[model samples]
Target: MTWETVPLRSVARVDAVHVAPEAISTSDVYVGLEHIGRNGAIDETYYPAAREIKSSKNRFDGRHILYGKLRPNLAKVARPRERGVCSTDIYPILPGSSVDRAYLAHFLLSPEAVGFAAARTAGVNLPRVSWSALGELPIPLPPLAEQRRIAAILDEADALRLTAICRLRLFQKLEESAFELVLSVSR
Candidate 1:
């Protein structure tokens, strides 16, 4: 089936709600670029209080897809689980009614979109993909049902990959213990 391609802006818009550092409550969660992982992984463990944030930040709800503008090649994107504030260097994008949020996040995390962002980024020390440039990215649109299905599959794959990684680490640790036991017995 042929999918209609449209500009990213047609499916999502950057939420521009900026909150001053002083305005943010001390208990508020703050997410910086460091808190976001490549390929839509989020480091939820790093929950810094708002008081730790020195600069102005953008407010985002769970519905927002946070995309890191700086160093776009790293593809720092995340779907936050709760309301929080993020660094100004990140854009909190909200999907349009026609688009599924998870689908949009996966699309943005795709290598194609990451390459497009990397090419469009400017600045030497702090290369970034501006909202205008990112908005112009071509998105392959499918029916809403298909979009959700694809997103679900991708999410499942991600979960499986994480499980595999954890298992590999556990095996490595077990091997190390076994080796140590063997060496001790020889002694």
Candidate 2:
């Protein structure tokens, strides 16, 4: 069955929820656009709001995905590995359980979807995504089973990419070691 493409505003409310600054006693989960990965992984570390929540900040279950509405091209988004909170800049997308987050996240990262965002982003000296246009953004859908498969494939590919990066780093370290050894011997 074909899933309907509803505006994000229809799927769930995308309003910003504020955290009082006085609530925090210690530094905790900090999230910002810098934490967002171009590949859609979010690393919540030292976010400004994290310093403000005493008991808890804006916590989100892994089921919900976060988006960076500030910059469209960044493709900054992620589904929390566990329940966690983030800064006010990140939008917590609380869709009904029927909506597959993995599916939604995958769709959000599509070049076509990001392209729409690029066309609509408006600003003067600093470019900011058009949040209203982003709200009404169209999302494509596939069967739930297909969505799961696609997510799995994506995860596997991501693992490989990370592995390749590690190998490249090791190779570079070896190259540096070899150069150092040559210099020492010559001395």
* Number of the top lDDT candidate: 1
Candidate 1 lDDT by residue in tens digits, 1-187:
8999999998899997999988988767788899887757778787777667788889999999999999989989999888889999999999999899999999999999999999999999999999999999999999999999999999999999989999999999999999999999999
lDDT of 2 by residue, 1-187 (tens): 5766777655555534555546543444555567778887776554554344453335456667777666677777777766555655567777655456777777778897777776777775555665588878876556667768887888798889989989999999999999999999999
On the 0 to 100 scale, the lDDT of residue 98 in model 1 is: 86
Query: What value does the lDDT take at residue 157 in candidate 1?
Result: 96
Candidate achieving the largest TM-score: 1
Cα RMSD, each candidate: 1.0, 3.4
**Ten-residue region with minimum lDDT total, candidate 1:** 44-53
The lDDT values for all models are 0.91, 0.68
TM-score of 1: 0.96
| Runs in model 2 lying further than 4 Å from the true structure | 1-6, 10-15, 24-28, 44-59
